[model samples]
Target: MKLLLVDDEPVALRFLSGVLAGRARTETAPDGASAVAAFARALDQGEPFDAVILDIMMPGMDGIEAARRIRALERGRGREGACRLLMLSCLDDAEHQIISQYDAGADGYLTKPVDSADLLAALANLDLPENPLDGAE
Candidate 1:
């Protein structure tokens, strides 16, 4: 599994990268623009990941818009969208309001300061029928 992680904080990036070491092939983007660009690069490079971990708040487009664009790409590809999205947010009750309001194309929403075990569990649960917007294979 290749992971495209988009976060603005260097510390958060380091922590996540370290924890994800044995789980998947991890690639990162520090902001929204790079997230989209990196997504394209991964597709073009023929090394698309199984999932994406995106930060909800960031400079230049934010995670919602980026996800929308990725959905568009998935549509254009004429197949089930492959990359599951895990949204990371700092907003209170983010899973309810913040994620509910936006069609950010996420497989799941996780609040900030997430633990390592929870993160791994989220990834493991990505295969659930209700989770993968595009039905899992």
Candidate 2:
């Protein structure tokens, strides 16, 4: 799958990239604004991402806002819900989870320090094509 991973922290971005190393073709963004720009560019190029993994906290244009914009972009193109969004956050509270789903239109939410197993499982559960990560170690 083609994936966009957005995280403000360099370490976190690297870790996630490593985790999904061979499983997906990934593009990384340091912040929400860059992520949104990349998303737009990809769509314009006819190479939109299959999924986006967004970090909740950032300096500007947080994940929630980015997600809203992405949804808007998709709707504008008549391609709403075509991209699966997964929220990765340090906030594991119920409120955050609710906001990520209902407010930000995310397909899934996972807490920080996530392992490859949980990440893959979350992605798999998003109604994507059959278990691509199955037996991946």
Candidate 3:
């Protein structure tokens, strides 16, 4: 899978990328703006991400807003099914937040300090191809 991993903190971004390195083609964006830009560029390149793991809190634009915009962009391109979005936050797994994320177009949610197994499971739950590398071959 081609994954976009977005987070403002350097450590979290590095950790997520490290965990996903050999399993998928992963890209990183340090903030919401860059993430949005990267998402657009990927679409333009005809190699859009299969999933986006976006942090909920950021300086300019939060993950919710970014998710909304990304969805809009996908809709505009008529490629709404092209990607799955997973919102990440440090907030408790409250019902409201999960509801809000779904409203904003997130396909899944994961609280911060994410468990590796859970993260992988969440991706699996999206029903993506079992072997991303299969596409290349």
Model 2 agreement with the true structure over 43-81: per-residue lDDT tens digits: 999999889999999999999999999999999999999
For candidate 1, write residues 35-117 as lDDT tens digits.
Answer: 88888777777766678888888888888788877777767766346878888887658454455245766888878898877
| Model 1 misplaced regions, further than 4 Å | 94-102, 128-137
Top-scoring candidate (TM-score) = 2
Give the Cα error of residue 82 in candidate 2, in Å: 0.3
* Clash totals for all candidate models: 0, 0, 0
**RMSD (CA, angstroms), candidate 3:** 3.5
Ranked candidates, highest TM-score first = 2, 3, 1
Q: Which stretches of candidate 3 lie over 4 Å from their true place?
A: 93-96, 130-137
Best by lDDT: 2
- Candidate 1 yields a Cα-based lDDT of 0.76
Instruction: List, residue by residue over 35-125, the lDDT tens digit for candidate 3.
Output: 9999999999999998899998988988888888889889999998678888888887677376646678888888888977778777777
The candidates, ranked best first by lDDT, are 2, 3, 1
What are the models' TM-scores? 0.84, 0.94, 0.89
Which candidate would rank higher by TM-score, 2 or 3?
Answer: 2
